[model samples]
Target: METKVAIVTGGNRGIGFEIVKGLCQKFDGVVYLTARNEERGQQAVKKLEELGLKPLFHILDVTCEKSIEDLAKHISTHHSGIDVLVNNAGILDFDKAISSYEDAKKLIDTNFTSLLTISRILYPLLTNTARIINISSDWGLLSNIRKQVWLDRLVKDDLTVEQILEFVNEFLNAAKMGKSAFFSIAGKYGDYKVSKVAMSALTFVQQRQFREEGKDISINCVHPGFVMTDMTKGMGDFTPERGAKAPLYLALEAPQSLKGSFIWHDCHHVNWDD
Candidate 1:
């Protein structure tokens, strides 16, 4: 039998690291720990090794197209395809004013655009039974999108990726003009929230497309909860291990019937209000 493989991006530390540790303990095959920095990736692997868990390290900078392509090629050549993928790599800058166009653009690029690119690049290498879990946040709940028109578009069953991209660009354009004040969620940490919303929107789009293609793959977005991590500046309530449980459950335990669902950390399905 071929060796199964799971890849977790941003696995060098925090929740990503905990996810890797859990997979190493549960997954029946190789668990890869990927990070943008090689040195940190190696260090993370070393720490896992201390626990007698072996995790492969790969350099992955989600924002870089070449890096994503390289990882995909490697997976294709060495493992045939990936059985599991956790898009845990994302960024948030609390210091940047939410209204700053530059800051918001950067957040969108890293949190949404890069994940989209990486997913597309590695999609070809996904096996029929592959499970793809997108790490999103509760802050991205559809309720945050107060504009009726925008909310309608997002919840539309037939929403297209092109349309979603257009919506994101439109928001960015509005932000550039310093006129995003009308946005209901454009307050402190608004960029982070907006980016997560976009990510969730993309999740729905991808799930629909996959179903339309008649693929057997399972795709889902999840909120890992407000965990105590570097991103939260260690001010969160849950530990990294506790935060990893939700994603781990989705990756290893969720049934095929649960595909395309938006799950909360507690493993409950979120109802997107119409």
Candidate 2:
């Protein structure tokens, strides 16, 4: 039998760490916990080891294509391919008063663009029944925009990946020109929200591509609820373990028939049209 393997990016802490632990306990194969920092990543693995759960460690910086490519080559060489992938890596710059174009680019690149890059690289290595979960936020909902015109464009089923990239680029460019508030819906956390919206859009596009290619892969995105993490300054109603539940479900138990859907943390289908 072939060795089954799973990879969880940004798994050194918080929800990602919990997801790695869940996979280590439940998955019948090896689980790799990836972090950008080697010391932190190895420490996370050591903590899991204390629990008798063996999770390997890898250094991954989603913002760098070289880092993503290196991890892909390592996995392909060692495990033949990947059975599960949880794209838990993401960022949220909470400085509402800071609106630098460079920061905006970083936010979108880490949260949205880099995901597409990694997915593109690792997709070919996915097995027949593989599952891919993209961790998203409810803030990406169409309702957040408040403008019917922009909301319609985003929720439209026919929206293409190229169009989504164009949309994000437009926002970033506008921000660079000192018009960060140019969009009606972006408000303060414009960069973070726009990045997640693009991620949601990418989920739909990839799902359609997979179907067109006749693959049995399951790909979905979910809002992991507002959890207590460093990103939230440790202020949230839910724990990190609770936040991991939704992504873990989408990665493992979700039916193949449930592809391309945006799911709430409670595991219900979200009405993107609303």
Regions more than 4 Å wrong, model 2: 146-148, 179-185
Candidate 2's error at 161, in angstroms? 1.0
Cα lDDT computed for each candidate against the true fold? 0.85, 0.85
lDDT of 1 by residue, 1-274 (tens): 9999999999999989999999999999999999999999999999999999999998999889999998988888889789999999988764555557887887788888897788779988889888999899887777766566777788888887788787678778767766455255444566677778888888888877878888988888899888998888888879999999889999888887788888988888987442
Question: After superposing candidate 1, which stretches have Cα over 4 Å from the reference?
Answer: 97-99, 179-185
Q: After superposition, how far is residue 163 of candidate 1 from its true place, in Å?
A: 1.3
User: Residue by residue across 1-274, what tens digits does model 2's lDDT show?
Assistant: 8889999999999999999999999998999999999999999999999999999888999988899999999998898789899998988755453467888888788889998789788888999888889898887776666545667687677888888887788778777777544454476787888888888888888888888898988788899999999988888889999999899888778887988888999988997547
User: Over all chains combined, what TM-score does candidate 1 have?
Assistant: 0.95
Where's the lowest-lDDT run of ten residues in candidate 2? 179-188
Q: Which RMSD values do the candidates have, in order?
A: 1.5, 1.5
